[model samples]
Target chain A: MSKQSLGSLLIGMLIGVAVGVYLGWVQFPVEYTNSSMQALAPRYQDEYTVMVSEGFLVDRDINAALQRLAVLGKENTPDYVQDLTERYISQSNFPAIPSMVALSEAMGRLTPLMEVYRLPPAPTPTPFPAQ
Target chain B: MARSPRARNGIRWLALLIGLVLGIGAGLLYTWEIDPVIELNTAPWQLNPAARENYVIAIALSYARNQDLTLAFDRLRAVAPDRNVWQLVADIACERHRSIQIASNSDIIVMRALEQLYRSQGATGCADGQYPTPAPIVFMTPTPTSTPIVPVGPQATKTPTPDLPTPTVPPPVATTPPTSDRFILARVQSFCDAQLDGVIEVRVFDARGQGLRGVPVQISWGGGQREQFYTGLKPGREPGYADFLMERGRSYQVSVPGLVSEPRSIEAIPCEAQRDGQTVTVTTSYWINFQQQAN
Candidate 1:
């Protein structure tokens, strides 16, 4: 309440604030993890799987696909696949439906609702005469 | 001033403690809640694992519709930063499909598109089956067949006197193929070549390595990504050397039509050194010279 007390309080407050800022911002800063897919959280794991599925469709390589999915951790992998396929089914995502069904079947969870086949080969080409 | 010395000291310590607590509280509040570190416009590489996957999926979808490989590559590079990005993309797509989360048309197309893009760029992955590219559509014009009609008119008897003068004509000299018209895809390379600077330098040359001028060359990246160029367009440069600038970080397949071998596509790989001290750079244009033997 007195002048001496007020002056000391103001000076102390200034010093305290500078120390606090230094500790929070400089000493112990926030560190980010999960910068790569391998460090993905549970919430994002399904989405990453779907992207991986799209990549599989592109390359059509089953072995590589399995290897990449191996990083999802052995325990949660099957459940994750099941959940994603179920979500796709609920949404009726047609483009991914067949492939997802195929994947589900591979995971030993569900049968494909429909069968898709590759295009038939074309007729033999007629040889052209040499010029 | 009227207070005792001990009491004053006690009050001073109390003030200092209160100040310290209040200051720490305010600092923590400001830094953690109100004005925290914000990563604005986070580059693809800076994204979390989940977000990076989403970004790669978007790139695959974009590539499926537009097939802009150069742009796709640039985007992939941003996310990957290190390691082979296409292989990463391929692995991701394959895993998702294998996991059964991809159950839509766009997802399927994107998967195949991602595969094609990576494979074309020489990266291999596991999903290597049944997603064969649809056969290219080619319209073949059929030549109508007609039966040969037998000559019905009576044949006239040939005279015997014409045989004497038929042997007197001189033989014609053989014409050779033009030097500029016969460029082969002998060394089609894409790099950060300072001389090339990311342009497709279609150099037409003879076996002697002399640059031929004014030779027209066509550079195409499939999907209607085609352009025409001619040598000598730069005046001072060799008459047979022309340049077409490819957007940076793209896999390009150049063909001289009749001259290129089938099933051949080349990408401008990142190179560290070149002949002499000239180095490859992102902005430096490059040359894919074609040489033909002189006629």
Candidate 2:
């Protein structure tokens, strides 16, 4: 092959390689899934229901809801309690949900009950009422 | 001997190929090593909205169960790199839960919860220091009992004729001043004005007209909003007693545990200033009240 033709072919090959690499490495795909929150388990169904119910109560009477929860704590709360709380929180039912400090205390009281009822620990507890 | 033109062109092509490789290498190095390091090192509060929102939701969901504000705040701060703390809280609350709305009307629910907490704790004022306040006294009423005081009373009365000294009972001393009856109250002055760049402020004072220090204050506005602000004695040009940025015409309220006698609200108005021959207007508002003394 002529030297000029060889040079031209080499340059074309280099450009193609560079473009290919840039397209392969530099391009990023947009992630559309909300992968943060995990799916709820069946065992937590009752707890989720209660949480939603309490959340509804919080809209009208936060004090009453708290009182009810406190009373539930004194007794043997059901496994569904945690699920309810989570559901209510997820639904954003409480207008002025207690701060993390207060929520932690409430959860602390509920933890033992949850244990007795044989409910599993929530997916993320550190930031929840426990923090 | 004539050298082919093609042979000479090959040499030029080799030089150009080398230059292109170097340029591409330089670009890759800049993007990978330098750019990524800078982005990774950026503060959590500095993250973009979508990332911040995700972090907030995660932290809030955890906080809802834990109820540990300091930890929740720290976790949230780590995820949300560039935003203000209060603003972050509000965003998280709004995003994760429908109940924690961040609009003006929702302030009442937050204030009411805080009020109940303080009342139950028996906090006299929102002041940072300890002060005397009355505690509820449960006194048992004396039960009436019937007993037969037989002949022994007649024999004792005959010997007791000697003069009996007058009984004296000193009056009850007042332990606290009348002004102590006043309670410290804190309320949101204003919040979330686009013009003010999304800031909120809270004001606190005792019934005796003194500024309270070190009292934690939280302001909740917007439906599904979960923002919280703390109060300190120091005066400054930021949210909390000194100054705050808020959008004009927005409604807000404030809450201080054990201080606010009633929930308070405020609507922001524009304040005017002049700088460099130009008139500048800013929006401001406040919630104010005296602390309720423990009864």
Candidate 3:
């Protein structure tokens, strides 16, 4: 119970706290092995959205595409698709633009800017006249 | 010996050690519990099971559209750095099949996409061939032509001409060939390997000699013991490659369902082979090859 011992204890405690903080935040930060889709980083989220959009192109099922996109925990799935489609349009991500536009159009989120990117309608047969 | 009084006042090392331990515990508690590291910039490998499944589904569907195997492999590698990506996809497909997740058309497409991705990569599972891929849709547009001008001459067609039936375009049909008894055994070669014992390796190929995936292979032994397996189960092997092990001194027949040729019978006879720089006795192994017959 000497003052010197107490002083030493306090100093040691302060140094330990600093070391602990450093280890916790810098050296060995907590790693997450199980994160939901919503926890994905912004870039990855955008990539996932593009993938889903591409899937929509393959399946052409708007409802299913919406259900898949819902896992991102977006407030409004249609608006999110619309915004992303427009953003891609603005950014000229051409490879992803058509699918995203198709998905947006399916979700009723197609904007004026997305009109040019809409998938061209299937060609129809031209009737022949009697020879 | 006379010593200085200052030497008698030694440091309380035990107390300081105790204080350091207590402080470390407190600090860890504050950092891990009170305000932990923010969840940001998580990689695909960190995704939970459900999220990972979704991510995999997206990848498969994307691959289906793009047919970019390299891109798909790269993306899947990011998701599973340590494991075989094709097998991962096959497991997901099997899980989906077991869960009856094909209630909707989209779900069925997802299953097909997963199968297409894995089977092409020579990975198979229980869900193999559970959902057949739909044939691609092709539109046959007729070329437009100008109307022929008919003169209004009274003598040309005074009598009413018989009405001609209008020609109609046939409905679009699936382009995939029928899956009947179209496969015939091409070659059956027996070999003995120390590493592979009493194994019947089956390889099924298309008419063009290209490997086919998802074809079921059946093996039957005494006592009516029968087992069915599909090709492409081993990612390290060819897509049409599958294998079965036979016990020594036993006879087995290998056949593909709906196969036109007779099933091949073989005996697992004993043989000598090299093993780890030493001679060892092993059972004979056979390789069965089946090729699709020309239509």
**Which has the greatest TM-score?**
3
Q: What does candidate 1's lDDT look like per residue over A34-111, in tens digits?
A: 454544544445544665554555455555556557765546665667677777777876655555555555556563
Tell me candidate 2's fraction of native contacts, as a decimal between 0 and 1: 0.04
Q: Candidates 2 and 3: which is better by DockQ? A: 3
DockQ of each model vs. true complex: 0.16, 0.05, 0.51
Chain A TM-score from candidate 1? 0.50
lDDT of 1: 0.59
True contacts kept of each: 0.35, 0.04, 0.66
Encode model 1's per-residue lDDT on B1-295: one tens digit a residue.
5867634654576666777778777777776666655433234576676667666875675455434556677778877879778788878767776777655554566566666556444345666433655544655556899989978798878877755655675565334434444445545444565455566666665443345576667666747787666678886654666777766466566656446334246555455556476653355445565655334
lDDT of 3 by residue, A1-131 (tens): 77767876886688778777777777887889999999998888898999998898888888888899999999998888889889888999899999999888888887899999899854566899989
Quality of model 3 by C-alpha lDDT: 0.84
TM-score-based ranking:
3, 1, 2
TM-score of chain B of each: 0.39, 0.30, 0.51
What are the chain A TM-scores of the candidates, in order? Answer: 0.50, 0.23, 0.87
Q: What share of the true interface contacts does candidate 1 keep?
A: 0.35
Docking verdict class for candidate 3:
medium
* Segments of candidate 1 deviating more than 4 angstroms: A1-38, A41-44, A55-64, A111-131, B1-78, B81-295
Write candidate 3's Cα lDDT for B78-154 as tens digits.
Answer: 89999989899999999999988889989998998898777654567999888875554665567899999997766
